[model samples]
Target: MAVTTAPDRAATPVRAPAHRVRRRPTAWIFAGPAAALFALFFAYPLGASLLQSFTAEDAGSTRWVGLDQYRRMIDDPVFLKSLVNTGAILIVQVPVMIGLALVLAVLLNQSWLRFRGTWRALYFLPAVTTLVAYAVVFQVLLKTDGGLVNQMLGGVGIGEIDWLNSPTWARISLILSLTWRWTGYNTVILLAGLQAIGKEQYEAAAIDGAGTLSTYARVILPQLRPIVLFCVITSTIGTLQLFDENYVLTKGGPDDATLTPVLYLYRIGFQQFDFGYAAAIAWVVVLLIAAVSALQYLAFGRERRR
Candidate 1:
């Protein structure tokens, strides 16, 4: 009887599992539109930019220059100045902002803090505020005459310091604006990192007779290293590509003291109409960012392994 049933096995149709059939098309259906849009927008533009970087284009002609643009970039005084300016800001601003953010995050994480929510919102307000609006407000507040900051200084029997005219002060003003706008964002991130740390570790440290400074140094800082690395890398990239605040507030003024890589790229592309050179500059910036990110990641990995 069993052998008889086997005779019909060749004609039997096997069916796919119901869940397999259902899931087969689910990913495509949900992700298809997003994939299409990303290809259309990001991929296409990035490819075009890469291609354009190698080709010199004029009003009526186009030709491949192979690295000529890059060579020119090396000799461009404006580009050099922009690089120096951006490097200065990156070296100074990132460390200061990260330290301040870490301090603020620690302070805010205390459970007994009063008006905690209000304080968090207040600190984060500048991040959400419109760039132009805040920049304008700062411009007005730091104005040479009758500005609020100067008025307050006068009332306090202090001389009204020049906020934007002098080169050093212009750089200071730019850094201050960037710190005010971005410090809260970094603090929020660090606060989240601080919260993710298990309370048991702190309890263990306390049981070991670790003081407040010892607990933070030995227990908390080690765990927070990855988050700190993330903040540093992102802040480095942002500082390297800085444009908006300098453009709106200082316009790279005081003899180009605040000129950044992105502003230089914008001037090359839009102002000078040298699309090929601009594309090359953009690629250089991208490569520099990638190298710095890789170095940071490698350093983190080495520390972790140790």
Candidate 2:
């Protein structure tokens, strides 16, 4: 009552500056490790690879070769063949997988479907299976003689088809293996996209007397466009860099019919010990992937604008 409140009012101190100082260090502490790791791992390797691409190592000496390796890539028949093979896979396998995934996703999205979880799990199992294990299984199953697939084909009056030794059949085998392993992964992604769509849109379509196909065409497909583009881009990149199945299943055999850009790069870098050429090949692949991804993004953007 003796003016105590008024006496303390002017003496109040500000702590905001000290509080900000404390927070700044805390923020740096949290972000520093991640930034450091990214620099050490991704940035350093990428830079080193880029540097290597412009230089050549010969007779234990390193010298700048500028675009020589890139020029050599253009003239190399094996590189061209690998590029064509990768493109063939990208063009054929990506669409087939995406279409199959969309169909499976839509089927599994039906709430009335029985054992939906189990079905999804079964479909997704192959995606999680070990790469080598699946490749070995496919190799055994697709063997030209006495294989399970050929035996079944023989029962149906179809002659034994060489899956691994012929160029065409080897490419088909690679495509089939890729589709089997990746379709379910894409299905899961598409299913997530489907689930994100609002139910009210479906209800509205139903009220408008829209059929299932019409509803999907008008509503679902439009909404899923972004996810579809994402899947396409990723699948294209994966196909461009295909190596594991080629290595384990066919070893890029039958005159390098199934050889991919990455497999070619591996042969150059490891098998032939041409690190600089491999680095150049790696950069070319990066450029191709970037170009394709950019085109897809632009197309999608144009459609969205329209």
Candidate 3:
């Protein structure tokens, strides 16, 4: 009995000092600031936006109107046009930009490529350039009459294009501008993912008589799945919220062909002072983005798990 009692006492845990044993308080101290910041910045604004979306503007006073604003949004032809344009951007521009970025990243990752650092710096320059600067520069360059781009085209016997004043041309111009600005950023991100892939895999593929294209398609692409998914989701959301370029360059002009949800929302809230309708539009845009992002995650996340 004494021997058994001694073994049991030794097996029991002994309480240590608070400084030596306690981890809960230290964790809370480290996490408290970030938790408070998130609540103030993200959580509060989201709640406010959702609430405001359900309200109405009556003689400068906001009154709760339930789903009237939402129903109005469903009937707004202008909003529908903006949504269509935003969808066009996603369907067209995002893939082009990402594809170009992948090609550039592969070329830059080559050990034998000369002046690689300089090339990378040149490519990445536009991403760090101010948004306003890019808009202003492109606006000048792409001017329909006596512009640099048209002048160059004329040298090859092509006539001047009314880039911003024409509906099709305006959409094309925005897409090209966005691609040029963001492709470099995507390239840098893809390059980081490419670098993380093991050199051994490439060597092994080469030993098996695989060429560069074959190796990239089979090995490199598979490893880049996560990075590609991330880029797709981010670019989708950004394109859906398209506003700045349309505002600065076209003002959703050429008969509203270039209008985006965000631009429409801005016009309603800030320009017209119809905060209730704008809030409703903003919420609709958010829901669209969330739905698309969720779909992408579900598709990619399932593939990753397998």
In model 3, where do residues sit more than 4 Å from their true spots?
1-4, 7-17, 20-36, 302-306
lDDT of 2 by residue, 1-306 (tens): 575444575578756887788899899999999999999999999999999999999899999999999999989999999999988888899999999999999999999999999999999999999888999999999999999999999999999999999999999999999999999999999999999999999999999999999999999999999999999999988888788898998999899999988999999999999999999999999999999999989999999999
For all predictions, the C-alpha RMSD in Å is: 3.5, 4.0, 2.5
Q: Identify the candidate with maximal lDDT.
A: 2
Q: CA lDDT of 170 in candidate 3?
A: 95
Per residue, candidate 1 scores C-alpha lDDT tens digits across 1-306 of 455444676688889999999997998999999999999999999999998899998776989999898999889998899898888888888999999999999999998999999998888888899888888889999987999999999999999888888888988898899899899999999999999998899999999999989999989999999999999999988888888899988899888888888998998899988899999999999999999889989999899899
lDDT of each: 0.91, 0.94, 0.92
Higher-lDDT candidate among 2 and 3? Answer: 2
> What does candidate 3's lDDT look like per residue over 36-114, in tens digits?
9999999999889889989987887889999999999888999999999989878999999999999999999999999
C-alpha TM-scores of all predictions: 0.90, 0.92, 0.91
- Cα error, candidate 1, residue 197 (Å): 1.7
